[model samples]
Target: MRPLLVAALLVLIWTSPVTARATGSVLSGIAVEDVAWDDGTALQIHWRTKLDEDFRVLIVREGTDGLMDTLGLFPANVQWVVDDDVTPAGTYRYRLSVFDSEGILVFTAASHGLASPHANWFHRGRLGEALIILGVFAMILWGTFRRRDIYLRPIGGLSAIEEALGRAVEMGRPVLFSAGWGAQLDKPTTMAAMNIFGWLASRAASYDARLLFPTHDAVLMAAAQESARESARIEGRPDWYRPEDIYYVTGSQFGYAAALDGIMERQKPAVNLWLGTFAAESLILAETGNHIGAVQIAGTDSTIQLAFFLVTCDYTLIGEEVFAASAYLTRDSMVLGGLWAQDWLKIGVAVTVIAGLVGTLLDWDAIGGWLRGI
Candidate 1:
């Protein structure tokens, strides 16, 4: 009877719950959401740590098999993580396990999720940006119809054009225009150049001063001739238009430069307008014009060539001033509207920057992070 009682007591000791402590819950609120703007291979995991828990949270990713693979380890304070190493279009499961400092499992919580990345037509994050763009476009159209006036700082180069042409007339010498070797009719710089040329030709014809346009491309020559002809007709001096005044030179860069240099030395043009695209040959042409005592006005989009024109030419259009030249001369509504819109945009940017700066100092992370992805 003593042996039977001892055996029964041993069995109770082995099976008793009084010796084992239950594991405390360490994680909660496990949620998974699909990631935006990505192929179907990722999901975002969000979770919360239990109050007063001091443990390492080990996030494990499980597949269809229900077997856990350790994704990452973080402090219990971490609330969110992204799991990117997922198979496309495949279902997945996640388990958030907590471990004590001694590496013993404390508690775990799990959530099941699956995401197959599909391309979305519109990114939810960019919705605000799209609205702002639409708003700006509407503003531009409204201002255009309203004939909103824009204030432009007086550009000395643009203002000096009339004076230069007048000096050419007084000297009784021809006004020379070169669009440089790279001035093709299709390029924006060259197109602007032609527009300015049309204006210049009009003034020249009205003053009865001769004008010449030398080009490296046949197409540009034809374009220049038409521009001159149209300007003459507009000024009621169709007979003043001369095809020989707008002619093609050698397409070879240096060859064209040499020919123009000879013209400068011999013709001694009173006004030299070097506008549009140029190259390394810019310095050479500009130097010759400077030596000939010609009043020079130059504009170009070339970063490297601009330095030469800036110093050598008596007046130079900096940056997009070349593009704005036509608008200033003609006052066309389309260009004026665009310029007004641009000015307003600049103001908006300045205000946004100032506001963002102030907000950042005050701990408003949202405003400052606008357009950060840029």
Candidate 2:
């Protein structure tokens, strides 16, 4: 009977399924890798394990002193972690320690190979953005080489410049142009205003109308003088360019507004052209122009002052219309090509936004993820 029982036990032991024993140090497959396409400031740690909520993973990195330093404590189920506190081109190794539900040390593992981060020339994540930028530049080159008439939407404020000058000529009153209190030659709005000023100066010279430009900035005053002089020279009427007309007023914001109001009231300009940057004084100047019954044409990038210009001025160039004024008026191929590229970019952005919205609605994560450069 003892021999028969021993044989049955042996058969049962051999027939049972072979399973891995839950040894205390069971963590395996630890790996350390470089973070890809970054500035080389990070490393990635990966491992494989079957752990529950009650277990925790404690990661450590080899310090400069050759001792392990704690990286972080993580949940047991996590497969990977990013260590951003690494130096570029520096080799790193990692160790992971597992703790059981009772907070007792259970398992330990170390990465087999060293990993070092290196910077990539281009970011892999922003590939879509890079492609879009390249496409924009390509479109710009195409527009430049083609040199066709790039049609621009006509701006009412821009179109009314000649008419405003005509009214000034008819009324025998000077056409007043101001770049407002915050005017600076370095500013885009001010530069665009100067471009418009050049065109207006040329037209004013042709009509033999007096064009007055009062500036708040001395540097802007200098630029205006040069632009006015060049425009007059181009029109074969350098004598019409008055250096005194583009003079600077007080730098004080309210003081400048007061001086402008005095000029507008005393000179009684039939045409008032307000462009460039403005502050609280925008309403004051526009109101004064409206009170004097001048044909007020205004353009600004300032959102708050836009409402005042819209209400008080006869014609208002909204937002980017001011920037496009030079290209629209001059029709220069380079500028027109830039505008063309800008339009194409805008179209691309709009299409991308709509596509992302549609993709989100349909639960297609790839489209939205790509759009977000993920």
Candidate 3:
């Protein structure tokens, strides 16, 4: 009985399929998660291998009319496979096989499941996109709560505003203000104009000096006129708000400047404030203002026109300073918060740039490579 049992055990060991030895290669922890979409056509496959071996995946479609397709080859132990330009939406099966330096030998654990290409916005954007969205909101809110006054370096151009207004009062001449082309929207440029103009117009009333406000947009012109009138009333001098002075000029760029040039020649304002965004007509207005002997103070974020303002205007606001002007003027909490946040960001940027420069000089790749990746 013991001999018969030993023979049966030997037969079971020799004949059982599970006793077969690996054919010079092996695949262990094979897995496939949910498929990911690539564009409108492709799909991404994620899997794991037990051993490191060179292998290729062959995706097969199982049905009565079956078809087999060799997907592509990838490194052994590779955990991912991306197949692009796949056929239209349908259920399909997939499998992976192991290959050697010579030819294909070992097979991977079979993956027989449905692969359907479905359309979805969440999939299009991805589940993790909430991270970016939430991060942006957090930054904005963080800026608002951590609000602090930004240490602004002195700007010669912006500082000239008071000087110009004072000069106009001393000279007994009207102050001219052109509220740029797109000053209607409450963007940085337009907001700067509102704050600066409100202050200047009030001072002009106090000095008993004339103020001329030219408008390119009806809405902005209306707002400026009302604001100036309201400011003059606040100063107990509503009569100083002249409706004709805030009259509508043509919307055409050249036409507006030409009309303004005529006014500058005749009225001869002692001070000119050019605020908001300007274009090709900037130099034309500046040159005219200069010719009329107006002490010009300009503020803009337009890099293209900065040089023009620098050459022509007595004072010019540059870049972020224009954006920070409202916060500086109003001292509002939320605006100050944003300005402080941006200032910190700017400091971070400056430090990164300085670090990169030092690292580059030392032939170090740490900072340089990290910046390149970003």
In the range 83-147, model 2's lDDT, one tens digit per residue, is 99888856778867676766555666668867888877878878877887788889878766766
Q: What is the lDDT of candidate 1?
A: 0.79
CA shift of 363, model 1, Å: 8.4
Q: Judge candidate 2 at residue 92 and give its lDDT.
A: 79
Looking at model 1, residue 89 earns an lDDT score of: 53
Give the lowest summed-lDDT range of ten residues in model 3.
56-65
Better of 1 and 2 by lDDT: 2
Tens digits of per-residue lDDT for model 1 on 289-329? 99999989998888789999999999888768888788787
Better of 2 and 3 by TM-score: 2
lDDT of 3: 0.70
In model 1, which regions exceed 4 Å deviation? 1-140, 148-151, 352-374
Which candidate's lDDT is highest?
2
lDDT of 3 by residue, 238-285 (tens): 888887888899898889889999999999999888878888888999
- lDDT, each prediction: 0.79, 0.82, 0.70
- What CA RMSD would candidate 1 show? 11.8
Candidate 3 local Cα displacement, residue 161, angstroms: 2.1
